[model samples]
Target: MIGALLIILFSTKDVWAPDNINGLILLYNGDIETGSIVRVEEYNLLAYAIQTTLTQTVLEI
Candidate 1:
């Protein structure tokens, strides 16, 4: 199925920070509260946003 294929491409990393956490803390935060960020090599600054459980449900089109 397409679902299984998508999981294969994710960059799996164990994250631990105050702003948020994932993988291990999947329950209380609603099934899954995953996040990803990018850093522009020219600026050397990072930015990210949480793909919250609610937003995902509405945008699953």
Candidate 2:
């Protein structure tokens, strides 16, 4: 019974791992980025996501 329980626990964790594909940059939380998500680097302890936006200024000079 113990062996079966262990297997079930491990399998459940693996299923959760692949589901969450998004990650946040801890230091730069306020900064907005533009472009599509290219990749994610788990080995480097980093999460990468991209977004797209136009560069413009609201204030008239």
Candidate topping lDDT:
1
The digit string of per-residue lDDT tens for model 2 on 18-55 reads: 43322233214534354323333554333333442232
Number of clashing pairs per prediction, in order: 0, 4
Runs in model 2 lying further than 4 Å from the true structure:
15-61
Query: Candidate 2 at residue 18, lDDT?
Result: 41
lDDT of 1 by residue, 1-61 (tens): 8887656545332222322443235436555434445455787766553554421321121
* TM-score for candidate 2: 0.24
- For each candidate, give its TM-score against the true structure: 0.22, 0.24
**Predictions: Cα RMSD each:** 11.4, 13.2
